[model samples]
Target: MATQIVTSEANTAAVPGEALEFDDIQGLVFFGHGHLKYSRYVFLRMKDGKQARARAWLRTLLERKEVSTASGKQHPGLKDVKGEHALQVAFTYSGLKALGLSPEVMTTFLQEFREGMRDERRARILGDTGGSAPEKWQVGGDATMAHVVLVLFGKDDADLDVFHASHRDCYQEALEEVFIQDADMRQGDTEPFGFRDGISFPYIKGVPTTRGSDALGLPINAGEFILGYHNAYGQYPFSPRVPRSQDPGNLLPDVPRSQRVSGEPRPKDLGRNGTYLVIRKLRQDVAGFWKFVEENSRDPDKSAEENEANKELLAAKLVGRWRSGAPVELCPMKDDPTLGADSARNNHFEFRDDPYGVKCPLSSHVRRSNPRDTLVDDPQESIKLGSRHLIIRRGRPYHDKFADGAEEQGLMFVALNTNIGRQFEFIQQTWMNNPKFSDLYDSKDPIAGDNYDPEYPGDEPKDYTAVVPGFPVRQRLTGLPRFVHTRGGDYFFLPGIKALRYLSMERTP
Candidate 1:
């Protein structure tokens, strides 16, 4: 189901650990390749001595996790997946501390994860306000600190029912969980805004098919997403190190830290077979978003038929794709749902041909986010640069009626990357939030970014300009406000099974 690419990295080298441990890793990472349907994102806090007791409870829960390898054989018993229930567990830095992990180990984490995402200034940059602000956020906010997040994937509601029963039965010890919030999977892969998602995933180096991802010869360094491997730099990503004495059982990989061009040692290998996970709750203003599209879509002199056509055009330009998930570059004039439904035809378009900002605007959501040769002349260089900023997203939509005084729904934005600063944060700040992106003046990302024009600062009328290409006169739409905003989010580390077991301190090899 992957689009064909002429470029392939045939000589891409790989690190040790040929096969990924399905049980140790969470199935969410692979996107069920397409088998999974329902998902429950549960965030919980450690209640006092719950860490010690939770460790034991985690061991019991591990047995029920449905892990699969490269071969995705479906089980007939399950309605959605051919496999059993899928589960993955991750602990935030605070959660790790709650588990009694020493400060020495904790100090090695990234500052973004340590300091967190609560500052008002940063919130403004991320388009986080209203339902997405920390005040209304459920987890990883100033109000609540979640220690662990358990992602459970089931075939259907019946499957989730069974999971709830198992969770209750397994945790009879009164773990005193501080708080728990659940984000359910929507019926379709579409978000609340009704745009089709879960397309455009990266291809891994060693692992051939991640079910849902393309095995394009353009294989990315697995270390970019996983620990203990060669990254895009052909060197191991910077990770934490511990004394050999701490892991005497040889459960962890013996890899050097602070690797440059050559393999070198730093200290502990706490990051091997693990990746940094960023979880953010972004609430979409569904009504406000569509209203903006309708009001500003037409020119005063345009005919009724022309105005109706322009409405969809305006909305599609914002996302760089149609509601059917078709890229504007491929279907610039009209949405081709047939082409959009086909993965091969959907994502196989280039922006180099649209230099004058006609087909897809430079500041459009997809273009700003990925750029993809739109930034430079050489496709190879663009691909190489894009590879560095690539991230594996495991996000799902959440719904809560009458939330924030409105029907509340947003994406549980989860992503995995070796370098949080370089990958996730870079995209949010340098690309998505930056008002001036790729030579565009006074316009931020049309959808995700806050439409903040610095020229008209503080209480003045602020508006964003979108230049739509045309034959006679290019159409310009202005006065756009922020649509999507961040409510709450935090950084956590999703450890491999071995790493999780090692964190438990119960299974010593």
Candidate 2:
């Protein structure tokens, strides 16, 4: 049975942005978990033998064991203080640069994550997976690889400029020393994959006084995402968790019935603000994708240039949104590069006025990812879904090789949402990965057609209807093969500011 969410009636206060003073330019490190004591212990280990002030500051945090909580039941139904991982840690980019160590030196001298004194109490931080793989190392395309590499290795600013200039040998050597020896934690935003990815992050209950829309289309509450239930005015805000019917079929085997785990958990408490981030280094087969398009164009009899145009059109249709970011549901044919690049209007529309794939095919990546108003067309249904399917995607593109030939390239797909089960996976398996969208019919997501016809018993028929309203109906082009492939992934919770402070001090108890 799926666990039910228990709404809390506690009133918590929020802290204003001014009160929470922190530099955003610096790179930050985030770690999340259930216990404050465990977090502090880890922090102590992380900061050991560092600057005296940093060490002393960490010592002070250890002494301050308790972090504020809202009714001690952060998210009324989804998670609680005990089962909840501490959900801690945030290190500024500059602060990391101030660590005062060279990447090469630190990589060689780094201590294991566990404390020397408490070897029996191993830090659960080391997972079986995540971090760099020997054959496929990754770096964010949006940010400089040198910067990220240095940050990951904990090199201070004094060495950054020199190292970045001509330390490839030193840098690569150090990176291998650290990454290859032990699995280090990795972080980065998602790429610009035409859809608004992270907009749906759950507001931290006591953090993120910055008001924003979440995937569920509701106002973000600080108390819902952080430990302390305080507001911008330094006042406690009260909002009761709204309960809904529990679906038994949603539970995975071996998952405890006592703990509710679903895709859409209500963000009703402060500590619930931090979202779990799952990062995957996916390599796209761009050449293969285009080749499939070329062979499958309806107008093969046309000139070579016409054939190429048709292939590009097919690519646009599958993605549902142009590379420029315009939704095909809105601009079906030619891309409005201006609109796609505009943040103000890029993610603002839905496929309501025009369904039936007339403008955007139902199977377009964006459309399938979030059917938006199309799935539940009725006004009331739209209202319900409007609050749902919202996510803030911060991703960057990556290529297999720097200059030219080689194979991989695509997105460093990073997605942030209040509820991973509800938002991310729901979009992946149910929408993008699923061939059939509810009762609509069978169709593969154009961008990710992994399950093009996973269960079709008969040989795929060459004759098929490729129709879109206002466009000429065409016959299916000869052949097309699956292009995308999933490499690996795991879930992680991003903690709030207070959580980070607590983690560094080794103070959970």
Best by lDDT: 1
RMSD of 2: 15.1
TM per candidate comes to: 0.85, 0.52
Position 398, candidate 1: lDDT? 80
lDDT by residue for model 1 over 1-509, one digit each (tens)? 21111112432333233355433444455444345566766677766655667777776654543333222343221123346566667888777777766666678676666666665665665555554567777666776767777676677768877885677566546344444445655457787787887777677764533223331225688778877677887888876555556666776766553442253333557777778888887778788888888887767899998887888888888888888988888888788899788765566666777887688878788888888775567876777777888889877788776646766787877888988878987888889877678887777787777664333246222556665665125766677666676767778887776666667665222
Over 4 Å off in model 2, which ranges? 1-273, 402-405, 438-440, 452-471, 474-480, 507-509
In candidate 2, residue 300 scores what lDDT? Answer: 50
Counting clashing residue pairs in each candidate, in order, gives 11, 82
Per-residue lDDT over 1-509 for candidate 2, one digit per residue giving the tens place of the 0 to 100 score:
11232333441233223222121101121112212211111111122344444534433433442222222333222223343322122222223333332232123211321121112221112111122221223321112111111111212223333433342332232222111011111222223232323322333332332223222333433322222234323333221121222212221112122223376353222122333344444556677767666666656568988776666667677776666656566677777878666544555666667756767766666667766666674744663453344444533444444465654556545454444444555676577655457444444555554432222344263422233344445333322334454333223334343333322332111
lDDT of candidate 1? 0.67
- CA lDDT, candidate 2, residue 418: 44
